[model samples]
Target: MKKIVTLFAALTIITFLSACGGGEENADAEEKKTIRFGATSGPYSDMVTEAIAPLLEEKGYEVTNKEFTDYVQPNKALANGDLDANLFQHKIYLESFAEEHNLDLSEVIIVPTAPMGIYSSEYKDIESVETGSTMGIPNDPTNLARALIILEDEGLVTLKEDVDPLRASLNDIVENPKEIQFVEVEAGQLPRLVDSEDLSMVPGNYALAAEMDLLSALALEDMPDDYRNRVAVKTEDLDAQFAKDIKEVVESEEFEQIIDEKFEGFGKPQWMKEEE
Candidate 1:
C-alpha cells in the first residue's frame, strides 16, 4: 500500500508538470500568430473594423486594427515591423509616401477611393456658388490638386495647362471668375470648417465623419489615372502567406459589398488586379 501511494504521488507530479509544459507551448504558439492592421479613424478603418474584420476573423486570422489619426504613421508602422499591413492610403499616396520616407512597401490590393467632394452649408447647389465666394480646401498636395481639378471640372476655376495634377493649386489657377477667396485648412478639419467657409473641399471619409451624406455632395472627384486607395505590406513580405491572406481579404466579395453598401454609389474607384 505504501509503494502504491508513493507511485501515485510521483505520477501526479509528472502529470502537473506535463500540463504546465503544454500550457506554455500553447502560449508560445499563440504569441507566434498575430496579424496587425493599421488605418486611420475614418470611413475606411470604421468599415474595416465593422465589415472586413469579421470576414478575416472567420478565416482564422487574428485581426488587430491599430488606428492612427495622421496619414504618415500607418505606412511607417507597416514598414518598420510594427504592423503587418496597412489599408488607409491609396496607391498614389503610398508610392509618394514610400519614396519620401525611403520605405520598401508594396501594394497588395487597390481599394476604392472615397470620392472627395465640395460641401457647403450656405449654397443650395454648386451652380448657386457665387463669384468671389470663399472656398476652403485641404493643404495636402495630392488632395489640394484634386480639389482644384474638381473646381475646374465644375467651371468654377481654370488652372494652368502645364500644372501637374498632383501638385496643382490656387497658384495654378489662372482665372477665377469670382476671384474666389481660398482658405487652406487641414484635411480632417475641412468638414467642420464648411459651416463657416462659403464652401469646403472635403475628403469622403471626413465628410462621413462629419455625418454628411455623400449623395449631398455638390461635386465628386473624378477617378484619377491611378488607383489611389490600396492595402500595402512590406515588399519583402509580399509573398508571405500572411500577406496573401490580407490581399485575399481585400479582394474578397465581402469587402466589395461593404464598399458598395456604405458608399452608396458615391465613389466608384477601381481595384488593383489579382496579378498586380
Candidate 2:
C-alpha cells in the first residue's frame, strides 16, 4: 500500500511540473502576437474594427482596440506603452505633439483620411460668405494652419508670402479679404459651431463623427500627403514585426476595398493613387 501511494504522488508531481513549463512556453510565444491598438472614438476606430483588425486576425494576431474620445490620450497612451499602436493625427500634428511632449513616436502607414472643409448653415456657397462674418477654426496650431490654408485657397484669407502655408497662424494672415473675424475653437466642437458661427472649418473625422455629410461642405481642402493621418507607434517599434504587419495590412488590396466600400469621399494618399 505504501509503495503504491509513493508512485502516485511522484506521477502527480511530474504532471504539475510539465504543465508549468508549457504555460511559460505559451506565454513566450504570445509576447508580440497581441496588438493593443488605440484610436479616437470615430471613423479611425471604426476602420480598425471593420477593416484592420479582421485582416490582422487572419494573419494569427490577437488585436485589442481601445477608443478614446479625444486626440491627446491616444498618443499619450502609446508613449506610455499602454498601446502598441494608434491612429488619429496627421504627420505634422503627430510630429509636433511628440516634440512638445518629449515623446518618441512615428508614423507607420498613411491611411485614406477625410479631408477638412469649410461648413456653414447660413451661407449656401463660399461666394456668399459675408464681410465681417465670424469663422471658427481649430485652436491647435497644425490644424489652425491647415484651416487658414484652405481659407487662402478659397480666397477668403491670405498668409504672408514667405510663411510655410502648413505652419501659418492667424498672425501670419496679411489679408482678410472678407473682414472675417476668425474665432479659435476646439477642433471637435467645430461641427456644432456651424449654426452659431457663420463659417466653421471642420476636420473630416469630426464632421463624420457628428454625422455631417462630407459632400455638403461649402468647400473641401486639397489635402497634402503630410496632412493625412497614419498609424503611429513608438519610434523604437518602427522596425518591429507588428508595425510591419500594420503597414502590410494597410497597403493590402482587401483593405483598400474596405475603404472604398465604406469610407467614401476620403481622398486616397498620393502613394495609393500612384498606380492608377
Candidate 3:
C-alpha cells in the first residue's frame, strides 16, 4: 500500500512539472515572436510607441519601433528585411517610392492622415498675399503636386485640365493669377521657412513636427482618398501573421482613441468613419 501511494505521488509531481515546462515553452515562443516596425519621427513614431506597441505587447508580441528622421530610410530598411513593417507614407508616395527604387512593397492598411495646409507667418490669410510672392512647397514630386493642387484650389494657380495630380509639376501650371513664384524646398525644411516665404504649403506631419498649429493654417487641403497615410510591408509578407496582427491593431477602437487624444487636428481614420 505504501509503495503504491509513493508511486502515485511521483506521477502527480511529474505531471505538474511537465505542465509548468509547457507553459514556459509557450511563453518563450511568444517572446521570440517579435515584430519590428519602422516610422518617421514625430507623430508616426509617437502613435506606434504610445498606442500600437502596448496593445501588441498585450497580445504577447514583442514590438520594436525603429524611428527615422527622413522619409527615405524607413522604406529602405523595410525592403532590406531590417524592418517587419513601416507606417509613414501615403499610398501614392509608397507606390512612387517602390517604383522609383524597384522595391517590392505594398500598402498593408491606410491609417489616419494629416491634411496638407498653406501657412503664412507674415500674412493673415490667403487673399492677403501679393502678386509675385514666393511660396515654399515640398520638393518631392508627389507632394509638390499636392501643394500645387492646393494653390489651384485657392485660386492662386490653374493646372492643365488633363494634368495628373499625382505627377503634376510647376510646368503643368497653365495659369498663375497671382504670379506666385513657387520655391521647391525639402519637405522637412518648409516649416522653418514659413516665416520667410510669403506663404508655404506644408504637410500636416511636418507642420506638427515644427510645433505649428494645424488650425492656424490659412487653407487646409481636403486630402484626396489616396493621400491617407498607410502601413507598408514587403509584398511577400502581406500574408504573414504579423502583418495581419498590425492591421487588426490599427483598426481597433483603442487605436482610434489614441488618435483622438493625441492628434486632435489630424484627420480621422477612414475605416472608423466608413458606414458599416
Model 3: clashing residue pairs? none
Residue 142, model 3: lDDT of 80
Q: What is the lDDT ranking, best to worst?
A: 2, 3, 1
For 137-195, candidate 2 gives per-residue lDDT tens digits of: 99988889889889999999878989987788899989888999988989989998999
Candidate 2 weakest lDDT stretch, 10 residues: 267-276
Q: After superposition, how far is residue 27 of candidate 3 from its true place, in Å?
A: 9.2
Q: Write the candidate numbers in order of decreasing TM-score.
A: 2, 3, 1
TM-score for all models, in order of appearance? 0.79, 0.83, 0.81
Clashes of each: 4, 0, 0
Pairs with backbone N, CA or C atoms under 3 Å apart (clashes), candidate 1: 90-228, 90-229, 91-228, 132-178
- Score residue 173 of candidate 2 by CA lDDT: 89
lDDT per residue for candidate 3 within 37-113, as digits (tens), equals 99988888888898789888877888999999888999999999899889999887799789999999998888777
Native-structure RMSD, model 1: 6.6
Q: Which regions in candidate 2 have their CA more than 4 angstroms from the true location? A: 1-27
- lDDT digits (tens) for residues 1-276 of candidate 1: 999999999999999999999999899657535678888888777766876678778777788898999889888888888998888877687887899999999987666667889889899788898878998899988778889989999899899999988778777889888778999988989998789989999887788888888878888788573636677889998897777777787677777777677757345444433323
Local lDDT at 225 for model 3: 68
lDDT of each: 0.80, 0.92, 0.87
Give the range where candidate 3 is weakest over 10 consecutive residues by summed lDDT: 267-276
